[model samples]
Target chain A: MTAHATPDDVKKLAALARLTVSEEELPAFVAEFEAILGYVGQLETLDIAAGSDILPYANTFRTEGTPHEKGVWTPDIVKAFPNREGDALSVKQIIAND
Target chain B: MESNLASLTITEAARKLRAKECTVRELWGACHAAAKTDAVHAYLEVFDADDAAIDAAQARIDAEGENASVLCGIPLAIKDNILIKGKVASAASEMLEHYEATYDATAIKKLRNAGALFLGRTNMDEFALGGSTENSAFGPTTNPHDTDRVAGGTSGGSAAAVAAHTAIASLGSDTGGSVRNPASYCGVVGFKPTYGSISRSGLIAAASSFDQIGPITKTVADAKALFDVLRGTDVLDSSTAPEGSYPEFTHEVKTIGVPRSLLEQGLDPYVVQAFNTALEATGCKIVDIEIPSNKPALAAYYIINFAEVSTNLSRLDGIRYGHAARGETLLDDYLLSRTEGFGKETKRRILLGTFVLSAGYIDAYYRKAVAARSALIREFDEAFKTVDVIATPTMPTPAFKIGEKSDPLSLYLEDVFTVTANLTGMPAISVPMGTVDREGTKLPIGIQFTAPRGADERVFTIAAAVTGEQLY
Candidate 1:
């Protein structure tokens, strides 16, 4: 129930989130992060009653009937892509070779 | 027509338009003049081609005489987060500062059909991350009532614009009290309909479950009119349900419940007094209600908010149409771009979200928060059965001065009274109770009323009663 975030944990989280946290900002992040976690730790003491529905609803995304055909992606929608090749977004290789 | 057109509510403006007391051009001129008259810093950008847009709307009104929508030729400010076709939808972040919306949001599309005129895009907290517009990357929006203080945010600009009479009414997205917080601070009516009441098709998502687009207006009737146009299902957003998807508010609001536990702690005395006066004016019997979930509500709200924001923002890598930073590799590109593009508060949220959702901490934080959220929803549902509505001070206190709450936790506490509605997916509104003097300047405070899910009408009606306005 003692929730605390360490500087290493902060660094790891930032890395996972694809954010570059400078060394100068790391200590501040650690301090604030620990404070927030401690605040949220109060929830650990909550005794959730049995059979209390946790999820708001199941299959909220599913429709009752047949779905309509989606609109075709147009060239205009691709305007945000930094690099494009023949209507496809260009990306660096996901599978790297040695 | 004797009164200033700029100060007229949406209902009054529409009536005047229909009565030929003022032409659409004249109304536009009045609102435009008022917008230029103030230096609230409410707008990030006012469209340069306002005259052209006004002419187009006026032409439609002229051609469709007797058939025009109430919003026809009525100018409105839009929060920078909601998309207007071909307009820059920044979400007040550097990431999308130059990005143009590919298509209109479903709400915008509906409003367009209704012939609403766009005044401009107003500023907001970067990615709608903070409680005050102070976090806006562009700059903070100042409260019109007191120029030195903040307009409550992330809908600060929208609220300020309405309060200043810059726009007849405006739209803002509320994720954990964005709209209502500012509305209370700015002394205007702010409303969030039942979650999924309006489609989120074009809104830049902050926290998906809690995010809802709502209106900021001078009166409840104006909020209702705008809400009417904005609500409906959208094929693009599965979360939105069709009109009448939930049962309507059929019975009159007769009994109001005040959470006794919440009011006993840390509430400003003047705010409490104003709230009591508003409750007494309602003429409904006030009953003490206990919401056990209220204690843990803020903590749970932030946990879930962080988790969802982290996930939602993961889509903003350098490759897509926002601000892009160059790096040698794709990973480096994402890291550098986000680090540069996001503001301090945005980064803080993303990191917090990532930590909560991370493998080791997921169950300890994210899952428990969801369970706590569900408990809060159940508590709200139980309260609604016994009481027609729940009322509280919209914010613990009125608007704070700029830079007053620099620390994060102090700022998070501002949403104490408003987060429950968002968590429960219920309709809630903040109507001006009256003003509480802060150092000789009278700052407006609002009394918030929360109704059961889909009981949007009930909230509006109760608000009307509290404000001494006739129900629309």
Candidate 2:
């Protein structure tokens, strides 16, 4: 009763999540993924009729029109970064030049 | 009464402090001596024995006279996931091995103001992922009772510390029974308040929606005292409701709803016998209520857990903080860092999370789980109209041997009885009912009580009754 995740599927997932998986670890991860997915797949058998929302209710704490404020990052916290330049965290460029 | 200072509950310790029968220094000394040992591997780091906090508490007691807070001068163990400013706050993972907290969590700040002294950071499941402390980057914390068994996880160290009398009480974060499960295994009181009852400002996020910082103590009274001190709205946490947001639960508990259907599989006979005996002792009406969503609650809980964990842990990309690895490109940096930093369970969850939340599968897996979750909430709301609390054995079985249940799925199934409360956002507590024997050694199991949202008082009341102690 398992719709198993293939080795290729595992590789794709590892890449998507920015995690490296070695050849030795791939099979174990695949087996675990298959087991977990098959187990959680029981939700598919649950029939929720149409017109019923998945997220039906919000708690009392969820208030509308609450103004949000930007959080300020303290310098001490910024300095904790591995690649810091002049009190700012330095990161490699994300843009691609084709 | 036990003369051993380490064995004193928080209430008793506070009373002793008030009467000047035991100085805070002596209390700290006893707990410190207990903390110094690594026999159970309970502590990741025990703070320096000579701490100024003891002196500070004494000074405050001298000034305030009879007005000191109940937690004043109490030595407590803290889970590694909660941040204590300027101290190393690894979630028992190599990812944050050298990471130091820049500020105290809201809970820690409140405890500090209450004059509670932190003994040290205790070990836990790496990023609170697994049910057993065996996932801890440091070695697993063995059960204090048997020493050959586990002390439950991800709050294993905190529970073990309290059980072993290393600290009068300890604070643990429960995402999915992290606090309660360990509390059951350790034979102590562990409480998980309704979600958002306590501020989550300083806890390292696991499953954001389900995580709560709570207390593990020797008695329900002690747990209640810590919960009172810790529960409140914080501007730092948006999910928290203002103080007194939910009307106080004044309804007396006379009926307990037990979902008989959910107990059909996996529950141990010994635990069932203990639960039945406890139920008889309570003399409260046992109503066999059906929570239809209970069937899928575990599945839904894990789906939500994985999805949230995938998102929450995405921030540990090595550039801003945590252990970093030099690589040719930015992608490589993240991949290499996370690959080396995370444990086996953490990586597996992250992968499954990525799968369920992926493009083609979101609607089928994640969305359906949410619907199941809603169904669960509705069923619970309906059930609470008749019963004030729901009762179950905290775990399906007693504490397994240290290396038992090697399979991840088997480990996840252990959370079956405890995860429903987290899923429905209800308050639950694990109170030690009695011990059940495993082999030749006797292992303790707890009875869990789940109350409606914001009905924390009801949960405590029933729990106090079950434990045969008056709490507050």
Candidate 3:
């Protein structure tokens, strides 16, 4: 599609990213990012194989497990943080006190 | 002569240090003093442990002489996302506020070994998720040019620090235009090498595939100087492109291409005039061309980026290393920890990324974005086929007000010109073009130069060419 990624797209993207998109934010995202997508989309049909004969992107990242080793928690690394309160780090309560 | 090292590049700094013009300690101290006065919050922590870093650098310079490293004794600010051994890398988030880095990032090791003095860690958007450093849990970094405005972030603090002369070069990670956007805003040189060109180990990555750590400096030459110290394969980032054999930068400037589609955009009128003026001054042929698949660039960026962010951030379970909460059950602990450690923006992105990467909806968002990303790269390859390099306004508009953009998506538009290269994994840079009216104030605008695959050095060459039009 010649059309750019729009706010409806951003909202869908937000939903895909698991973010809660507010109603107030919808219009601005549409206006601002649609223009941005238009700028970026300008490259849609540049023929890359013709010259320098190179592929534009590289897919060589070493995918290692941030190694989510499922196991019980050890205190040594956790101790590095300054405040830990009863099996949890002591921090101010988030959200609101309503 | 007493060393006038503050304004010196890493190259000059090394020469002066070797000539014994001044000791590394003196240089380090001076950088610290200058950085201390910057109220922009460029630095998260300025190490007084300066003596050790200095002594280590001096020992190397004393042994290896000028060969000590490409960055010997040059003071640098690291964006908070990268790890520094024994130092806290907050990534400008409250979660890791008190958490100290367990190891040094591979790039940090390379530069440190080369004798670059660590100035301190700079502020960034919390978890490297936002466009504006405004999302930082700590505070927003004011533009060095105009304090009332933003620094063009997640790397805004790093860019501002370099522009303000607080540090000569700063390391910033560019994922979806974090580095180049801020570089353009702060009127400094921000270069993002091709994806996988620079090592990513030790960086608290926001999106794994797109993140690249590059230099944010005052000039293209400085960026090149730092790049030599930074670009290399590393064991930590086992995923680095197999030592992509690329040539050094060329001094000559010739045929450059500009996409008509990109040129005709929502850019401020003054910026448009300035971009054309800079191109005219380049004395190089301004061959107008078409690069299709460019417009969907930003939407594709948010998609692929947030999709990756969803999967990548899943590691921050508040269990292993990040923020953890105390609760009777594990579920409660996970919920409490995330809510406490993450800022509003980080949480928002995490949610967004997670949703996009989810099972049923994957094809609708993530797949389409990835396909679009490939299409964009193909488009860039095609353009580079015809032209040596591509040029565009680094940003459509100059740096906006601190709170002007309330919706996160609107702020993402600031990356309009820079994200195409990021999406395609092509090398791109933001060089100072000229000033534009920034809400009634004069602000710097950047002209972006992008080169073909493995043409990182070429991007620098073209930037140098553009910069020569009105070299400072």
lDDT of 2 by residue, B1-472 (tens): 2228988999989888888898889999888887886578899999985467899898877678579888989999999999999899999999998999988999999999999999999999999999879999888999998998999999999999999888899999999999999999999999999888898999999998889998999999999999999998877887776666566777478999999988888888989999989987888999999998888889999999999999999999998899999788888898999999999999999999998899888888888888888888889989988998899999999899988888899899899988988888789999999998878888999999999888898888888888898755
User: Candidate 1 on B351-377: residue-level lDDT in tens?
Assistant: 999988888878778888888888899
lDDT ranking of the models: 2, 1, 3
What are the root-mean-square deviations of the candidates from the true structure over C-alphas? 2.3, 2.7, 6.4
Candidate 1, clashing residue pairs? A80-B321
Worst 10 residues of 1 chain B by lDDT: B242-251
Chain A alone, TM-score per model: 0.73, 0.68, 0.49
Q: Give candidate 1's error at residue B421 in angstroms.
A: 0.2
In model 2, residue pairs whose N, Cα or C atoms come closer than 3 Å (at least 3 residues apart or on different chains), thus clashing, are none
Q: What does candidate 2 score in Cα RMSD to the true structure? A: 2.7
Query: What tens digits encode model 1's per-residue C-alpha lDDT throughout A15-80?
Result: 999998999999888888777788888888888764565645322464578653564445667877
- Can you rank all candidates by DockQ, best first? 1, 2, 3
DockQ of each: 0.58, 0.52, 0.14
lDDT for model 1, on a 0 to 1 scale? 0.88
Report, to 2 decimal places, the DockQ of model 3.
0.14
